[model samples]
Target: MEEKVGQLAQIAGVPYESEQSEITGPVAEMGIPRKLLPIAGSVLGVSGAETVKRIQDNYLKENRLGIPLIFMVDVIHGFKTIFPIPLAIGASWDTDLAEESARIAAKEAAVSGVHVTFSPMVDLVRDPRWGRVMETTGEDKYLNERFAESFVRGYQNNNDYSDPYAIAACVKHFAGYGAPEGGRDYNTVDMSERQLREHYLSGYKAGIDEGAELVMTSFNTVDGIPATANKWLLDDVLRKEWGFDGVIITDWASLGETIPHGVAANEKEAAQKGIDATVDMEMMTFTYSNHLEELVEEGSVDEEQVDQAVLRILKLKNKLGLFENPYRTASVSDEGSIVFSEENRQKALEVAENSMVLLKNEQNTLPLVPNEEKIALIGPFGTDENLLGAWSWRGEPNTASQVLESMRKVVNEDNLLYSKGSNIEEITTEQLEEAVQTAEKADTIVLALGEHWEMSGEAASRTNIKLPDAQLQLIKRLSELKKPIVTVLFNGRPLDLNGIEEYSDAILEAWFPGTEGGEAVTNILFGKANPSGKLPMSFPENVGQVPIYYNRFNTGRPYESAPNDKYVSKYLDSSNYPKYDFGYGLSYSDFELSPVQLSKNEMTPGDEITASVTVTNKGERAGKEVVQLYIRDLVGEVVRPLKELKGFKKIHLEAGESEEVTFTVTEDMLRYYHPDQTFRSDAGEFEVFINNSSHTSHTETIVLTNK
Candidate 1:
């Protein structure tokens, strides 16, 4: 322990302090210094088999434990083949593809010598204000649990964590980071024990269940204590209840964040608190490197905790077979060897194309008929880079092809008119004239709108997530144009789109498409691609519905009424409805839900039943329909939601075709968190709805009795 501590982290009084300088600073990283790894040895984001070769040359070549250093990178969505963000992927309910997406991400990231990925961020968030929601699977325990398992299997591939790229999966923010106050990053979290177990802790357990090898401590405090130093969380629930044996790393400089958290006296105190809480690795090392040894020598902390941390790190490395292959798989000559080829590009394009969500198409304004005339593309995001949203590492905006260039390729460059309507945050009139004039020259107008990437990521929280006034005003003005207007939105989180919906003829949510986003947009526009992407989150009409989701609890007065008068959960100012509910999307084709056919009209806690419905493609074209299954526990010991998303399935059908989609309504799917904190189903009458969208649907009823 003494030798290794001095070798890498450079704490004085530890053996082999001479090797400390080898670990250089100015570590190019996505987060703070402790988590910031030296780029000199990192071959990450490097294209090809050369990535593997470089990892061996840079990290494994040292004269130390002879164990290779594990390479870690972000594979949040899909790897080379990017699927929807974890949230969108969850909405897909296509477990096989979601798992395959993870596997492919691991495969691609592994090919580049990455040993681990900071992914499957199982932070169960209820607040949509948290910008990081775009990264999680969603807000349901069962759904998140299912996705968490898929993610682990995708990343780890069985019990073998030693596959070069088959690195360990990290179950993150240890506990309750997702329940941040007011939906802000690093905010305080306060919840009852029952609430914590029922809502937030399930995803962590699910990840652990699927063999997640590491846990990243959250930035927030659970109840009164910081999660980074909470023994009840890290030691008790994580270690005891879930039995997670992997190392726990703090969120970038989280140990140092103790000063702001008002938990520790100084760096030494922070180190002691975190070490006591069972933090296995100090991210960025400001607290640990600066004060760990002092605490150990001063007897403020047990030296055993430090050794325990190192032990976890070593074990993870050994699991990756680093102790076996300490040599670079290839040499510097192999750096550009060959990877990220045409095949990978095609796969990325395919995913991006599939991820496009066609949110609105009024008057059948979409499927733009290819023409020989001019096209107009306007909006700040049309040509600018970096607003594509969050956590895209080393994202180069200038290099990413802009929307204008893409439209030019689809049409004729000479005929494509371009205008930057306004910047993402600011409202302006300067570009309105230019945009209108450009639109005058084109046969069609495709206006891009939405928040800048920073407007929605970590600390990127917002009080008002609406379209900027300038862009909204611009769209209002452009709506008067003779040209058909198609608004392409570049967003991270769901924005309130009532203004745009009223003005734009068609609206396409083009979430900051990654590297090949331009191609995806162009293909979808020209009908070369069909958008099958579904909304992973609810889109509210205004800020008043900030916390609204598909799965919300039923209040004393719920949204049911016989007339226009009385007491209910109805808001005096607005309806208790989202602008677009979760799992809501539109396609060129139309689908109709038939009468639900349950295998039986009755169910008991022990017996299972299947709710089946026939979906018919009423539109002329073949399309994909995500049939949603929502259930309501009519009466329960505790308050229950009016309806909750129990299950959903995306079925593709040919024109005029019908397919029967069925879901097994098991007791687990019917169970709810009770006042006693137990997940048990209650016997009662229930309403089941099988719908095409969240707000619109078909319904049936069933009775549950004791067997």
Candidate 2:
């Protein structure tokens, strides 16, 4: 019984294995028993082969049962050879690249004595103010669902953990961790069950259905009860309804947080609620470790519940092949060869290249001629090496690629002028004058700017999502030069681009491109690579127009339907549109999309149709285009979105090249949760729009018959 309770506990390993374990700060504060360290089921936030092996060896030698400790880390984006942030990866819209990035991350982590990664966030985000939105794919459910499957497949290797390079994929923050109130981290999430099922649940459901081995409960509340202790969320929905039999783990210290959440009276009650909710493991807390044994003995918690949770933990360990080889590939000698390898770095560069979105290119200002144009690269990010954005636990920032150094490799030293316009937050007069002087000496100015690496991950939420005032002042100073200003932004979440967009001639959303970010951005700037990435999340015109997305349900008094009227659902001070729409992007080369052609005008529930369109690359260079398909239910049992993304295809076309893109639409694509909570499609008229963006105008109609 003691061993069973210990298996439910996950503690930080560094303190547990320290020579002064009895006096360590974290361990002593937690009040956890010194004897329980040997029996603890897992370790959190510890990496590297040497350290992990030492800790694992110590636990096994002291334990009576000989159960190996499973190691877990936040390996969110990349392990060592980092890739772009998840939001940037979503902009690429290439699932193949997404899968490859995950595969490489798994390989690197596996060799470092890691067993599971908490990644592929897949949270549906619309509010750019939420710092963790940078960790999500985007606002749309369809795209999130697709990326969820891709990341899970890449991590678990199609759920076959027998592969030496594979690691278990844990889809995180289950049940609306993204939609916190006012875009605050760890805040309450108040929404109806219908809203939860309609928009917030699909990504998690998709990841689970794709064979993700574990699910991490969210830190926020669902239906007013904290998710860590909500039986309706964990047991009723995730376990029974979704049919997920895998292990369920809580977010860091979340089970203990139930006390402040008012759901539990104390640690004992928190443990009782967690067990009743079917929470298999508690991370970074002793709520279960300190009280589970007592609860079971007192009859408040059944012994069978404790046994089931212990069995789940053991099953995950057995599946990881830890029982046979305690060190499943953790080797100090092999780690050097496998982690951050050249092959992995090249893949990171490719993913970075595709992840950048060319937001604005007036008069074809981009794809600059290196020798022809004397370029001035100025801003805080011009020489900054910390491009690996948030959640990069093991990624080295000082060794990462830099913009100024990368530009020197392509352009002559004399052709490229450099200056720091300002620091991230504060600007001095001397710095601003030097930046302006540097821009005056160059033919064209390339301004590098964005939020600091610390501004966009967990616990980093903001009320205003915009470039800092210092950077905006720098842009204002450089814009006065009138020598075409090209802006390159390095941010995690989408920003309010009002001030910068008006002055810049061309804009590239680089999104803190990881290890090879410098080379990747340089490639796009000099035409070595054409920018093909799209906006995964919408860029708001101002902070006031936030919480904006493409697939919103139409209001009875929609601005579009009643423009110029006072009673419409329109902002009085701001426009009702985003500065940039979802799926919107620019390319050096031009591509034209033809009208949508449907196979049939009507169909039954079992029927299917093919929507085809011809996309032509009329420009002088080759480029890739993401052909998007959207469908709108004209009427439904419940309110429907104006248009939902049904399908998408990314195709490459050279100059004068044309390709016929086709998507097969079936009844499954039209399914939704009804008023009665039945998950199915209804017979109705639907409008289909096929274009490169969600802000599409071309439309076709089709009907679904009850017969």
lDDT scores in order = 0.70, 0.91
Model number with the top lDDT: 2
Q: Candidate 1's C-alpha lDDT?
A: 0.70
Query: Can you write out model 2's per-residue Cα lDDT over 307-408, one digit (the tens) per residue?
Result: 999999999999999999988989888799989999999999999999999999999999999889799999999899889998888999987889999999
Residue 616 displacement in candidate 1 (angstroms): 1.3
- Deviation (Å) of 239 in candidate 2: 1.0
> On a 0 to 100 scale, what is the lDDT of residue 526 in model 1?
74
Off by over 4 Å in 2: none
lDDT of 2 at 236: 94
